[model samples]
Target: MPTYRTTAVDAVHNDEELRLNLDLLEGRRERAAIREAKAKLQMTKYYNARVRGVTFSPGDFVYRSNDASHDVAGGKLGPKWEGPYEVTEALGDGAYRLRSMDGTILPRT
Candidate 1:
């Protein structure tokens, strides 16, 4: 049986034929990259269309996730949210400085 290598050797008769095949392969790769980029943009648009932007201003009360606070001791039954912490500063891109009820600023945002 003629394997892939033998078939390829039979298909390309000369260096010119090999160069033609390489050019076709390069065109195929460029087209594939364009298709991939279009697919990514389509997926991004579909996802962003469904996304709702929630912006928090300074002094707004927000709840922190227990998982964010690294409170692993609570296990299954513990409260999912840790805080009614006050947002002290809006640090752009949904990050904020939080202050506990007692007025101590959290070390991390």
Candidate 2:
């Protein structure tokens, strides 16, 4: 009867192969991260370039849209805009505290 060996003798080569595979994966991860960062920067730049800022000041005459309560007379077919309200105060970020032409404070939307 003859005995056959069934064990690997190249343990060093296996270790080297594993180390190389790990290094390759690490490099791929670094490259992917860099690409993602560049793409985010491009998106930010594009949006900033195209975005327009709107500002409102006190005492500005602006129109107000009719609310749901206004639909009693006109219903869906009624007028959409109702006001030439005056801006009493600039609340920043395009918001304003408004007053009616009669000087009555309107509710904030």
Candidate 3:
């Protein structure tokens, strides 16, 4: 695959521009390094800025991410915030098994 270069993510502010200019001549290996750095910078930006939701632990109640909203109780029956799904297993990094509000064991939605 071709390398992905990111100007925005790898920016050196105007003051640092002169100092960073030499990295341009750093060749393919260093170019690759800068590419990786730019990717990591983008990932870090996403984690630091774009990610806004709060994290909950084992017993905490978290809303399920699915869009089929319905209300199951209070005599209302449409798609409601499915959980307060008790976080069960931490599958890999972002995936988890959630206990449905109705006590059904469903894959993390």
Best by lDDT: 1
Residues 1-109 of candidate 2: C-alpha lDDT, one tens digit per residue:
5334436446898889999999899899999999999999999999999999866688789876777236336777888887888889997766788898998998755
Please state the error at residue 83 of candidate 2 in Å.
3.6
lDDT of 1 at 38: 100
lDDT of 1: 0.88
TM-score of each: 0.79, 0.53, 0.38
List the candidates ranked by TM-score, beginning with the highest. Answer: 1, 2, 3
Model 1 steric clash pairs? none
What C-alpha lDDT do the candidate models reach, one value each? 0.88, 0.81, 0.64
The clash count for each model shown is: 0, 0, 6
Model 3 RMSD vs true structure? 15.1
| Model 3: per-residue Cα lDDT over 27-97, one tens digit each | 76787999999999999998998767655566656677435443354344455455567776666566666
lDDT for 81 in candidate 2 is 82
lDDT of 2 at 50: 100
Off by over 4 Å in 3: 1-54, 68-81
